[model samples]
Target: MPKKKKITPKQETALRCLQQNFDKRAELAPSSDDVHATISKSSPVDIDVDADELEKNIATLSINNGNTRIRYILCLDIEATFDGDKSFSHETHEVIELPCILADIKEGKIIDEFHTFVKPSLHPQLTNECIALTGITQVDVDNAPTFREAIQLLDGFMKKHSDKLHPPPQIGSPPPNGWPNLGPRNYVWVTDGHADIERFLCLRSCRINRVRLPAYISGGYIDMKLLFKTHFKERGFRRLPDMLAKWGLSFEGREHSGLQDARQVARIMLFMVQMEAVQLKCNRSIVMEMNLSFAARQL
Candidate 1:
């Protein structure tokens, strides 16, 4: 049997371009409702035969430059309350039972989220006060998957999304079977504070043998607690909440709901990206306008 050769980087890029062209072709087809609606938005005289030609031109441009290299961020936050007695005791330490939320953010908006409750194997019992504050009890953790399961699920989700980022195959060519050419993608998990990471590391009984999650997730994390202190020193910014308010946005929602908090964090980061893109576009337009004005002055 002959060994199949691996796809070179140039060939991989070509495959992506071909797939994008296929998507463009499908969009311009007559039966496509999306194509029809986009055509209706323009004037009748400018429509007709030019639409297909325009689509082909756009396809060429798309193939030449695709946004597949865009970064994807995994935002996460955890909510936990101290379990056991009301008073701090030397004999017993407050057991922290928590739920963690994970979200996938790209181009500044959160596209997917996962919420999971971690079963505190070491601290199985919960105090009444803790239950009231966190709304979590022994019953909740009884059947819930352990922290290890949650990590496995998270890893699987990342792999799935990495696969999804591929541009569809080009038209008229048989669909690139199950495996479309794959590429290296980034994964950065952000947490509200370092406590969540700390807690996971402290769990002695929990399954820690399989994967070293922290090392893999160290790429980019927007730690609000760390950012607040660093911002003041470097950028003269006061606090995260203050910065968010200045940007005309406010963070709201239940504090301990991991999913809700992760979503809010994703939204804030996405807003920053959107504003920067808009600013860049405006600056370009202003430069063009200034050049045109100077030309008119010469006339």
Candidate 2:
């Protein structure tokens, strides 16, 4: 019998994804209706289209290199308090935990970190399921800042970092399946999945507080789930644990801790950069014009 040739890990995963026909949309649980609706706002865009010679005065679209290198990256993860244990209700869900990291893209390591627990105004007492699933305790929320205060703290961090970092490039479109290079700093939001972005894009946080949406998230965010899809063309996204396992990685911190999740995301990003697979950037962002009631909010 002939011995089979060895295949690379990326190639192997591709084979598995192709064989399994993973459903990218299926990553969300049925109770994820809020996330589903929030994510639905951004539609997939066509970078280029075939045109007929007969069509007149059509602008030519150039092909992009699909290279989306950036100088810096900001990773964010938010864990909210929900009414139900399993399902997060959009009407009642509030941002109870937010963890973020600022990292040097070239260095592939975190430079600073910010994390805080937020007190939910509407649903002050976290449901039993939320505590068990997220490993947050009543004391955690009891001593935490209000949602507004937490946002202020995050804004302070970003402001300090902005002064220290380089300016961003001119706002421009990214390659298909890539994030918009908003500035020279190459700042883009990163998350393990779409659910996090949904929470912001939906503007639920702003509406609950009756304030304008924060400018921090206005820059746009990268969904690792979509980024992975771009590379592997997989049907569905893998759970964070499964994704880590594939790369021989173990969860470094607690499962539901926002800080841990943010750190893990940074590590994953660093791995991608080190392996030369970090081309993907964010492709969608919150259409805040529709959500912010034309009121401008500072970062």
Q: Report every candidate's CA lDDT.
A: 0.38, 0.55
Q: Which candidate is the best by TM-score?
A: 2
User: Against the hidden true structure, what lDDT does model 2 obtain?
Assistant: 0.55
lDDT of 2 by residue, 1-299 (tens): 12223557875564344223212212321221221222221222121322211111111111112443466777888888776735565776688887777777665456777777777887888888889878888988887776666665555556557755444221111233333323323466778776665664234665676543443454445677666656655676566666555555567658877777787777667656655356645555543332333222111
The residue-level lDDT of candidate 2 at 116 comes to 75
Candidate with top lDDT is 2
Worst 10 residues of 1 by lDDT: 280-289
TM-score of each: 0.49, 0.68
> Which residue pairs show backbone clashes in model 1?
108-270
